[model samples]
Target: MTSPSQEEDDVEEWRVLYQETFGYRRPLFHPEHAVFQFQPDPKFPGHQRNNNRERREENDVDEEEDVEEWNPWKESYEQLSRGVHVMNSFEQFVGAADIQCFDHIDEALKFLDENPEGHHEKLIFLHEGTHNVNHTIRIASDVQIIGASSSEDIAASVILTGRHATILEIQEGARSPYLGWITVKYEVDTEHEAEMALIMEVDAPPPPEPNSSGAVADNDDDDDLEKVNEIESDQTTNCAMVVTGRGVEPIIESCHFQSGNADHHTVVVKDHAAPKIKNSKFIGGSGGGIIITHQAAGYYDTCEFAQNLRSGIRVQFQANPYFYKCAVHHQGEVGVFILDDGLGHFQNCDIFSNAKFGVELTSPNANPTITECEIHHGELGGICVHEEATGQFLKNRVHNNAFLAVWICGGANPILRQNEIFDGKHGGILVHRYGKGLIEDNEIYGNVLAGIFVETGAQPWIRNNHIHSGKQAGVYFYDNGSGILEGNEINGNTLTGVQIRTGANPRILKNRIWNNDNGVLIHEGGQGCLEENTVFDNTTTNVFIQTEATPTVRKNKIFGSRETGILITDGGKGTIEDNEIFDNGQAGVMILSEATPIIQLNRVHGNRSAGIEVSSKGECVVRENRVFRNRFGGIMIASGSNVADSSLNQVYDNLDRVSKAIDRGHCLFSVSGKEFYPMHNFYRCITCNSSDRNGICQSCIKVCHKGHTVMFLRCDRFYCDCGADHLERSCCLRQS
Candidate 1:
């Protein structure tokens, strides 16, 4: 253990490290400007510490075309406030290159107008300035009005006063000069207190639990390694930072851009060159937080855009912005808006909500690649695709939205794969108006409507989706829609599990349909093939083949419903073959007056009512069927029913078997017939406590963890322990 004095020295060394590594410049508001140690060396590539040059180089990987010019959270520790001291040696705020006052937006415009040659290699630093850029201010052509300092003695941040539009109505010598200050003292205090709270937010770390292998470790090698190799991975900061205006290709990295001008945007680009902004934060503004517009592609990596009023990041007008490991959360409106003329490719972004859509795509005919995003809790849908927008959504967690998980309108086709869409109040994916796509391998559950609904000529292939617990059908094809619904596990939907209505002809194959109100409901003109599907345990019937829809149902297990297994009526002529239909509330197969389904080689048994009840047209070849154990007669062929050719069908128990001998047995299991063995793991306790339990959170799961705590992850059943609080599995167990 280090002594108090030694601890103090350690603290000093840490302060130095902060200064050297992240440029925690004394009281600097934005942490990004601090030079980062990516790997290997602190200043391995260059000496300036700022990543502007390196970022520019990275941006050059994709050659971009430029049409116009572009302009481009401190936690409190009151003692370690993130604002840097005013540079005394340099003029406090009065260099021709530096600014101490704004007074109006024109002053900034004037500065830019004078720097028409471009402020390259010159910084228009704003320190202790009462600059009120209430409106837009163009930058140094390629200039940086950076409020980021370079000092480590303190949490050096940049602060510029925004008293824009405040009228001076004070009486200096009339006994009322200081009265105004006193009158507004409490309000001023409240503002200061809020600022203090914002500053005091410390970047806490996450807790630790079981290892990746789900095993417990005795030592905290991971935690120690993390600390020893800790860099400023967190990029959140105090203010809204916006850099806009002209330049060929302006580059921005590691910036904290806060909005205080009472305008709507935090950091924005109206019309400018391509920008490469990585490792930044934009927080707490009323307007659209980060707006990237004007036809230039933007690249943002590892940035956090949180606590804003409008959309987190608005990409508009032919702009292509690619985001990697970015977070957009807690906004008033949309999380990320891909408006007309622009598309966004988002990778590994966490987008929750404060108000509206988590991700909104408005442009028609632009399908962006969205990979591995955790999108949840939107006021509207997790993702709203409108007007011919097309994209591939892969490896995403889309759940808990107020509206549909994915709402596609006006002919948008989004190929969805490997997504978990669950627990939403509305439908899962609604494809309307000629949208053509596939919904495959998605775990879609707990929704109100059909998991996948296609309407108005939409031909979507719905496959491999585990859809359950919805209020309506799991997959509904309606109104001229045609597709293939195959290989899906659809169960527990309140209504029909797969509803094909309104002329929709969907080939339903190899689907596991169970525990639904109706397994498969077919309405008018919905004629398709139901092949090799395991449809069972529905409340009403396994299949409700309605008028004029004669689907060829072959080789299916249709049973265990409250009513008849297969209900056919109104001239429905379905071909049913080799189906195992049993244990239904009514008959195994119910045929109405006009129904004439051809059934052959089916195991129809154990129905409470009848095995094959026909009124008018059950003229099926009842041959080779195993009909037995029904409460009533197996063949209840009543008036006008033509049940002919009932030969070779083995009937028993309920006196329904007409042909051969039958045997009964229970408890059937399938075997893999492959050789396998079990493995064993052993362990011993060292420092045994009074109670017998796992010693460490690694073993138990009750302790704090590590990292900048960018997200809150609840630990598993085991407690959490990591970071400063690691456990000693037992004080005795030793491999040494």
Candidate 2:
């Protein structure tokens, strides 16, 4: 075991280290600037041995014994001598004032109240013991109370215990009283407190009635009588510390607070009081860690809240606080709860391992800016913005929650930007139930469900996001969800990159979708406009429309698919127009299963199979498209399916199947790019003088015959004379 002298040296070293870490030169009202003096306790005579050694050397009167006097000012403990100090035992470093020892905190408080020798400047040091106080101790001045021992070990230091009462109430006008290095635990005697509240209500009188004149009569006696039945309805009583009133800004640093009352808070700050609390730990409290309400605002830095029965911090009723670098975890409820117009700025906070959501914002006006925080390991979710709450969440890392990392619902409209929301049990972000928000510039990936799941009438503007690398779709719209998905990189998901179903209609515009099972899948009555998207390199078809989905596939660059570029099957009906569909393993456009669609104005090329295929009784109007460079044939129609109007299409340069189409009685003029819908005007080559076995349309007479021309056939049937086989001149429209 170490000697007493050695223990004193260790405590001195600790005090010096603490000051070097947190000391700053400021006003006397600030705890960081409070000066502490290391005075020896008269009971501990071993501390004065250095002084005795100096006297002994002076009496020796030798050359070596005449050394200079020991100077405490030049010692290594100079930092502790200048600012706040941490002490090990009760008598390590007493303050500059008279060293007054008190066995009970109540007695010391009474002494300071009655002495009145500038109590604001006095420092009352509580010894290392648990002092029980039955009532609250109210501080009316700028007194400084610090406990002996390090704040890290609160139970081994000075402890103040109270039963169903406010342990410390720094009342109004108590400017900058510093409370540090102590543990305050308030116990709730629930049965007794309930009975007392009942008795107070029974003895209270009714409130006074309004005057007939609609004005209060200025009577002092009536005002005094009316004060008899005043009970605080805000539930701010029976806390470990209640700092109230305007301008009562105390410094609470390195303190531990615990409240056993589950319905109340450990620290309650209300009525415009703004305190500076730093480096404290609110641990294992049955109640919430702190409540800042009724316009109370404070600055909390580097504080830790863990194992609380309720939320770690509750900010409501227009309270606006600032929290920086705080760790709030292991709470029974949410880590942070902001409601009822509560406003706060949270930065660099780590909120994790909560029973419910890590951070929950509710009510219409609960708007707070949370940035650069890590919120993870929540039992329910990471962050929830509900009940029409609006806030800005920027650059936060939210992951590994039980459900979605962020949930925006119930008409909430929060801006989620530059956040990495991933690795959850469900989706990364969920916007549903009529929620409207701007989710832009966020990296949402590695989720079990969709990266962003929008459903149930929610319409958010999702732009400029990297929604990728998920187990399911990148962006899933379901059950009437409508949103604008623009300028996003949706790729590398195990399922479809974008999935729309069940009447969900999202305007998918200007997105780069690749490397998924399918680029965009619309099924089960889904209806949306897929416009201006570059969808390529998917494992399956680039776009799949089936099961009665009538989505408008327009103006998209759909290519580089393992299967067909666009697949319309299973009774699906849509307008596929103005799209560049190419470079697919199968046909560019595959229509089957009785589906009726308008395939018009598309450039279909570079496919391994036919450019456009109609099979399985599908009926489509194929018009005004450029079908070229396909491996099989340009446009192929199976026996059962039929094209309602295969007209005005430029179908050329397709090899191997043109003769098959001709043998099946298809228009030979279509191969030379001159066929159209059944026209009443046809032309015969009168200059060549051939028999009109198959009459050509007016386009063929103008381009193929030119000046050598022909007489108008005036035939109503769809016919072309280019396949007569007895014509002397070759067909000029065909590529020689």
Candidate 3:
């Protein structure tokens, strides 16, 4: 509302204040500090009048200046300049000076070249704007480069693009090139098909040259010039970040790396470089998230690696990487792949939902330790250790995998202890192809296959585990596999608790096996010892030995089986001794189909059928067994079978003491060493001292011995007085 002349005078006063306070040749304004006011100077009245006339004449040249508004509150020039100076001082102290701000990538390259020796305390700050670095910018030793606040801010402020070229290179002899608070993204439509955004090359310092006196000359002037030229020539590769160095320990913190190329990794640590990365994220790369190779080692803390085309982390060639509390998921291949002697240690990490195995290790000596981690929802197994890889898998929860929770093959020996491996489509742990290790103190259940499966000479020490509720056997050993299963609780399985077949020889000891279809099955030439095990409450035979399997089952308490306690059939031969076999629906020991089992010193009682039944050409030596309280006879030898020696067995309290089949149709009686055709055969009573000599025939045995209970004997010599007097005398009363 002021007059035109007064308004012109007020604008002139502000212009003089700004020029005197800032001492700038050109006018400058900041949008953020627009509310700050200016005061006119008092000492330069004639000079300010001359400047007012010059500014009024220049305002006519720019029409936009006429519509510009000024601040309402008036601040003195001293106050305004002091606030700006304080802020600028702090910014400059933190390495945010005007010389550090570079609008073009060439300016940054020139600055790096000028500071060849590298100021240790200096930090290069890329200004808040897009910077298309057409070539690589090599950083010197002990130099630090810090970008804007965050990855998103850097993305909006600095956009780096290169065509088949690396964006930044931390050159050789550069020590501790620390990169923080930045985002390095690779962008190229089609012309710039580069695969890298930054590369750190670490090389050893040049050796001193020999002078004419055969002594070492410390001449490094030409070497420095040659190194600069070599760095300038190495700007034409393709990667997101490549660390190629020997004995280099790079520190990267709070950085984000993403790539659009399908064959580019977000970060690659190669050639013995050991990098420590903290609180970083690698996302949306088509090649892989992070790769460590050529004996490189990496330590990552609280990082996230996701949405990669290949494995989230791929390590090979003796590279060792340690991941702490990181998340690796949604990968195209396995979450972490370690091969060719690569070693990895993953602790307290969440690895899930990958296309392949959660962690796959292969090749010789590729050892990795996965402890206290949750690995689940993998397309393949949770962890696949194959091809001579050995490590420790301790305290991990491996579940909900499509295949086995842990698949071991090709002689890989890994110690799996105190792990909860359950709810998988296949077995909980599978060992094949000569794989051997110690599986101890694990809870393995709810798997589609057996809880632990060992095949093809895989000899693992499976002990102290609780394996139950599996769709198949709790522990399955087949294909010539030999192992020791001790102190395990195997129960509630749909099939046999422990099955050994196909020539598997496993020493199963001290395991509580119950509530399964068959407690333990040794079949198909499987030979082992089932000792000190408590096997009970099975649906079928507690211990089934068949198909030429010779398992020495001793000192086992086997009871509560729906069928026979021990069924040895199909030429299976072993020693069954010192076992308590009772409370079965059928016989305690049933040997059929030519099976030859030596049964000794076993308490065989409380069964529905005979305590020991040998039939169908089965030959067994039943000796020193206490056979009693059975519904059928104590020992029943069927028609075609024979017990070679059934001695010292206390057979009592059964329906009959001992029942044996006798072919009476071929009986020929001989009297006084003369063979004669007799009408029938008579038998003697051993227990009763019978005065009545009632001779009994095979057909009418009950009528012949009305009040005398007798045992019909198959005597090939005589048809004499068969009474209690002659029972203890001889086999035949023949007067020769």
For each candidate, what is the lDDT?
0.60, 0.79, 0.71
Candidate 1 positional error at 343, Å:
2.9
RMSD values for the candidates in order, in angstroms, are: 26.2, 12.1, 16.9
Determine which window of 10 residues in candidate 3 has minimal summed lDDT: 665-674
C-alpha TM-score for every candidate: 0.58, 0.76, 0.68
Tens digit per residue, CA lDDT, model 2, 99-185 = 344556666666666776542335565545677888898987777776654344643467888895789998797878878767888
The numbered model that scores best in TM-score is: 2
lDDT of 3 by residue, 490-554 (tens): 99999989999888888999999999999999998988899999999899889999999988999
> Order of candidates by lDDT, top first?
2, 3, 1
What number of backbone clashes does candidate 1 have, counting pairs of residues 3 or more apart or in separate chains?
A: 64
- Which 10-residue window in model 1 sums to the lowest lDDT? 177-186
lDDT tens readout by residue for model 1, 1-54? 334355345445544544432233342232233222222223311332134345
